[model samples]
Target: MSKLNIDQKKIKQLFEDKRSDFLIPDYQRPYAWGEDECQTLWKDIFNFAFPDKELEKFNSDEEYFLGPIVTFENNKKLEVIDGQQRLTTLMLLLRVFYKRLEKMKDENSMRTKQNLAQCIWKSDEFGNENKEKLKIDSQVALDEHKNEFLEILKTGDAKDFKSQYAINFRYFEKEVDEFLKEYPSYFAYLPTRILNNCILLPIEADNEKTALRIFSTLNDRGKPLADADIFKAQFYKFYVAKNQKDEFIEKWKNLEILCKEVFSKKDNTSTDEIFNRYMYYQRALKGNKNSTTEGLRDFYEKDSYALLKSDRTFEDLQNLGSFWQAISIQDKNYFDENTLRWLFILNYAPNIMWANITSVYFMKNRDEQNQLDNIKFAKFLEKITAFIFAYSFIYPSVSQLRIPIYSAMIDIINDKEMDFSKFLFEKENLKTFIQN
Candidate 1:
């Protein structure tokens, strides 16, 4: 790999000379710079190269600097690996400069205008007139790239650039016309200076694989990365650290296994769809309660007890194991059940109804000693689960069936002589109450 010394002129020259050589491919996502970013870049460049000459006006010593232009080798073609934002912004600045020059009748203005025009808007073999025209020629290409520029111009506000280019371009022309009236001089010279002054750092590698590594590192260092991005990195590390890609893949493969096992018995719905619906239900419940569904999906997907195996710590695993142990002791028939019965009951029931049921049950079985016992606690959990499932199935369309079910469950719990069988097994009165 060879090191290339690059300055503003050299960088501008490369862009000017090789318009076709520097292609942002079909796979690359659209330019996403909004008004704030574009404005910030403009201000930063203006402050840097053309610092205030007046001492009183110069407030700070902090120097403004633009980022490097990232390019990759595509055989003889140099693909823009990064820095598309800066390049596109510079292009806009140049266009603005040209517009400003065209307004001036002076010879100097004409000369500067010709220089700027020749740099970015030279005619091609097919007589394609200018950069602006070529940019909007194809809808597919425009949608992929140049739409943002058109949008910033159209709304005169960076926020209103919808997914269409024609709408945005109309605004762009309007903005250019308006901008020329106020800061004609600054517009003419500022863009040309920015194009001729900014620096570019070209990252070179022997192969595309190495270049991609450099590209990834460059991106990682700059932006505020996403949680999903961090998770992918952690996942890669976890795979390498354990040397168990297959094990991880197997775990993911079996993620829906518990869903299938539990839902398969009913045979009324697809387990995958039901599990998705169950998650959506959890989100809705959480949102209804707290106006946010934060960490509910995460809890369902990644934090569930059944997936962790023996790797979970003793304390964490102990609590989870105890819950399952209690369930086993209470229901003796279903040992391998992964169903979180208590959670499901609370989740399915209306908030107020669930609260009432909880209060009644906890009040009746308030003894500290009995509460700690796995078998006893499990029986209470099972009763709640059975109550919820029975109510939900019996009154499938009713929005607030939890009120009646909670009342019945509380009554049954309080009255020792009142048989649970009467409410659950009889089903007719309970079903009628739930339906009504």
Candidate 2:
């Protein structure tokens, strides 16, 4: 494998080889396509295979361009940077075709099955075990689902399988089976068509930066590139600029991994929601009205890289991430009954500016025992939460409360005395902002 290994190959050519392995990295999002996506693909193939007539004739040699896949080949293993969705789904289709052929067991059927199997996996020289050429490599999900996924690939059985991947496989099995009923000979022909006709543009680059640039240039046309992925790449460039690539990568990935778990949809705190909550609080402190109404992207633009020093931004993110993990969910070591009350306030508050403000305070006082006792902190948080809840209900607007609380918190944080009650009393609109 060279530093760059770009190529244009049919699906058959891409997977039907034991020469290299294909892997979707662990950090990438999980397999998330559903019935709608799968149905669209099924329609495309069916329409292309038989344009106007129903099962009239076949052209297995003719190709249908799918799209591009960005990758980097290291040690004969091509890591999929993009386009894993189509590739993984197509692998499911091929698995179905292979099973259909193997059932026939004719001499010709056996040879066809063998060739199609090449697209899915490679057998060991001893022929005891098989390796799937394309691997999803999400260690947890893969470990749980691989045995079942590969079982379906080898045997085509649909027993006790309800995972999204398995469910989609069954869906494809049903659609392809219906099509085969009309054109019974199509089963034998699909392997040839899929291998030779289903096309993809595999652009292998020198590194992740080059591959990400290519990905952005191509896909950014549809969806704007002002999101987290692009922002992450900016940080990567910052690290490279400072000659601290190794340290940045280690810390950044650790934070990303932690965020992924804490902010997963399963946790009922999605990645965006966490960031938005913090941003809401931040804007409130700055007296930014948009904090209550708009998203983080509006305030933290990728082009706003010059607004803050890169290293300071890095440290802020790292510290926030540390505090976030502790208070994210209920942990006995971190969350007490009072801390629980504070969490309830976060869930209850409309603007969540209070959370952003309070979180910042906690980050500053993480090691300070006198000011950060759970019982006292909880009473303080409970007061803010109750006040905001009443005010939001009365006014039905959270945007109004953002500025006052932010100012009060700042005054308190900066005061050597750190008197929460005194700061709240001094602030005008204390009833709507901090008083209960």
Estimate the TM-score of every prediction.
0.41, 0.55
Which residue runs does candidate 1 get wrong by more than 4 Å? Answer: 1-11, 53-65, 122-187, 204-207, 223-436
lDDT, candidate 1, equals 0.45
Minimal lDDT window, size 10, model 1:
134-143
Tens digits of per-residue lDDT for model 1, 376-416:
54465566666656666665543445435434544545454
Q: Which stretch of 10 consecutive residues in model 2 shows the poorest summed lDDT?
A: 134-143
Reference-based lDDT, each prediction: 0.45, 0.64
RMSD of each: 19.0, 10.2
Clash-forming residue pairs, model 2: none
Q: Judge candidate 1 at residue 280 and give its lDDT.
A: 31
Which candidate tops TM-score?
Answer: 2
Candidate 1 residue pairs in clash (backbone atoms < 3 Å): 153-171, 153-172, 154-171, 154-172
Compared with the true structure, the alpha-carbon lDDT of candidate 2 equals: 0.64
Candidate 2 stretches greater than 4 Å from native: 1-4, 54-61, 74-76, 105-108, 123-147, 221-361, 366-436
